[model samples]
Target: MTRDRFSYLAPWWLPGGNAQTIWAARAARRHFGPAPRWQRSRWDTPDGDFIDVDEALHASAPQAPLLVLFHGLEGSSASQYAVAFADFAAAHGLAYAVPHFRGCSGEINHAPRAYHSGDFSEIDWILRRFAHENPSRPLLAVGVSLGGNALMRWAGEMEQSATQLVCAIAAVSSPLDLAAGGYAIGRGFNRVVYTRMFMGTMVPKALQKLEQHPGLFKREALLAARDLYEFDNLFTAPLHGFRDTVDYWTRASAKPVLHRIRVPALALNARNDPFVPAASLPTLQDAGPSVTLWQPAHGGHVGFPVSHGPFGLPGHVRAMPEAVGNWLLAQL
Candidate 1:
């Protein structure tokens, strides 16, 4: 697609004309709103890795579908989006689970290598365990940002497998192109805040691993790294067997995997999202009919808010989880 087309599809938000800005403003209000509390639990995988899961059940759902949620990089079950979505599913009589990745659950994994954007093995394990334990119930997945990438890729690869447990899936603000994503947040003020936020989680995880093994990771070099791309290049790339960060991004980006998704999948992307470049998103050709790509003119990153009243919270902003809930119900 041409640059002009990309701009038209994912243009910058202008005053009163930008969905991204409006979404952010509305989401900010809803995000800060009070929410219901749920019980949290930790599950151990067969490989000795631990993941935190938040579960909510409704009285109406004696045998409802399970909606497993995955959060973005450095995000956890505590993330506003994850918790809100879980609550939304519960209201709609669907069971919900949000599994916190490697160290994001407050407890670091036993292994030295931490979770990355395309860490599918843990999610695969979760699916297997859930299926084995609850064979009667159908399983679905919803992912945001990095989690979206991993979930989408896993769905594609598992399309023809014997354990085709997934019935449907959805992802929001997925950085289909990791290389572009890094570039999006690489330069300028975004780099400073986002990079630090990512490192705040990753560095400590690495340090914890270092505290465990002491010799495996080059602590000094990793500590001195400046950007996400550099940090991944030094640690994530080598640990995962790619030549470097570039190679890891090249192989791990989910754009190439969209065509293989056989199950119903909804992917939402916004033109003004800071984390994903509009040009890198998959179109009808890249994503087969099985994948429905939803793009609004404006919604910054994960923000999607609709106005409800002059002073009242926008219904769309409050209804995102409901939107997801409704989608899950449709799949049933």
Candidate 2:
């Protein structure tokens, strides 16, 4: 409910919501820049699959605060936002690592199942292991889009149990209401552009998975899927043990569980976000005492383009990561 958490002003040239969101995903990669160096580690999951993590650290600060980053759907450590965040963490002397969701690490996973919006077990395993390995360092987390939804769900499920594991959490442009999000992205321009973009990669991946595990999925229905809703109903829901797309979206959404989150958490959603409708965003009252919902008038999806200086000197200033890093630093 408090509107004074952080101030974000979009760039002068980037005007509407679509422009800001599209440009960030399309044109802003080269401008925002990349991480200095990354150390890759693969962790084998108990379910016989693997999640790859790319770590970016300040060599001088061995015990600096650690941040566990979760990238969005179909996104990996190489994503523009992820790389930008890694750069920010490294420059600030914060040790950070991005854990790629199943089958998103540029390598095909072993299992037939892929990660969904609400799935958090893989992230939990990574965090628990990180906390165990580096007990001295402060732990914080940031999740983007789908990853953000999962982080919120995990925080809610863990409640006070997360206090020792993470000092605080931030969710940027998350689709907290999965049903609304799914419906929003299924219509008009979103269906033609965003849905196709997602399904383009997803269908092929599902086909590849089918090739490895014959007779495991309904190939005809999956191949016929034109949008996210159809894809979920045909593939994601069944593969994840949900009865249907409606059932999956209802249960997987982070909105229902936001009240249960016990950690100091920030959920930042752009009012103009193309994918997640502004109406779907949780209110401060719905989020309970521990969580804060900040809906800026601008900032499309994960895109928060600002003037320079925030991310060192001039050029493209990614506001979300800078805001998150500043908040985490304050919490620490």
The estimated TM-scores of all candidates read 0.87, 0.94
Give the count of colliding residue pairs in each prediction. Answer: 5, 0
lDDT of 2: 0.83
Residue lDDT tens for model 1, 97-179 = 78888778787778656777777766688878777776777888889899999888887777655138777788888898899
Per-residue accuracy of model 2 over 37-141 as CA lDDT, tens digit each? 778899988888888888874453767888888999899887778877877786677888888888898888889898999887766887899899878899999
Top candidate on lDDT is 2
Best by the TM-score measure: 2
- What's the true lDDT of residue 287 in model 2? 88
Q: Which ten residues in a row have the lowest lDDT in candidate 1?
A: 1-10
Which ranges in model 1 have alpha carbons more than 4 Å from their true place? 1-34, 57-60, 308-316
Error of 2 at 270 (Å): 0.5
